[model samples]
Target: MVLNVDNYHLKSLDNLDVKCDITKVRTEVIFRQSNEKIGHGIIIQSKHFDRVAVFAPFSGIIINRIYSVYVERIPRDQQWNEQESGTYWFVPSNQIPELVPISKYSANDRELIGPLVGVVVSKAIRFAFVWSPSLGEGICENHENLVIGGWIKFMAE
Candidate 1:
């Protein structure tokens, strides 16, 4: 759980209702199924998010962006630190393929965006992605969960 210490309150994301369809639908129907190509991912935030690509839910390798979000902070340190930080991931929209408008979301919605990486040590979340030898990866609705080591990726490697 690379949750922001000072930014992104979890409640802002929990049960965040976005108008997915113009008409209303059951909550169970919306998230119960994996909605095809729209997989989930963790939101990695900074004072500024750079070189980030915002793909259209359908197109790929698009040079231009449909939308972009930028935040500023002390220079970003892409290095792998010994301390356990949060893992980062990208949630792709299955139907659109390349279209994922994370930037279009308000700060609260962005906070809800996170990769289902192993376990989240923070208290704000309930769902987590746990690792297993047989299952590879699975979701567990538990907070303060820790992800097993040796599964995450860093730019250094």
Candidate 2:
């Protein structure tokens, strides 16, 4: 399914409910003027998963607006160095056409948000995403009772 931000209010993370419909996620979108368009560094934080930051150049994103969430399958050839700090990946402004959407979420409904389903190991690193009916979603670092197809990254904290 295609998600368009125009349907939702472009509000900042501070204006949304942290624990209700939006769940455990908190966001920050830092915009810069690029050729008369708005580019952004989008940070999505949740006590349950690893912190994810995405940069979109000339993305036309407005600060403090709520956008839908879509998780796309990362390309196997994509260079993601887990051992390195300050690493980033870039996607075109029209991400829907370029990447395969594996999951989609609407921030306005807690019921639609996906649960942590499973874990995967890349380069000997374990990643986990967890979800609970009562506790919501979280990242699981260590291998525990994992099934398959979950969300978030497990951290060592």
Model 2, runs deviating above 4 Å: 1-49, 53-55, 86-157
Task: Tell me, by lDDT, which candidate is best.
Answer: 2
lDDT of 1 by residue, 72-103 (tens): 11112534321232322222333332223546
Candidate 1: misplaced stretches above 4 Å?
A: 1-8, 14-57, 60-62, 66-87, 97-157
Give all TM-scores, in the order shown.
0.21, 0.29
Give the least accurate 10-residue stretch of model 1, judged by summed lDDT: 23-32
Query: For this target, which candidate reaches the highest TM-score against the unseen true structure?
Result: 2
C-alpha displacement of 38 in model 2, angstroms? 18
Supply the TM-score for candidate 2. Answer: 0.29
lDDT of 2 by residue, 1-157 (tens): 1111111122243422332212222222222233222134443322122333455543445542334332222233655542242222122244421221224433432333333321221111464443322232335443443323322233223
What local lDDT score does residue 30 receive in model 2, on the 0 to 100 scale? Answer: 27
lDDT of 2 at 129: 42
Q: How far does residue 136 in candidate 2 sit from its true spot (Å)?
A: 18
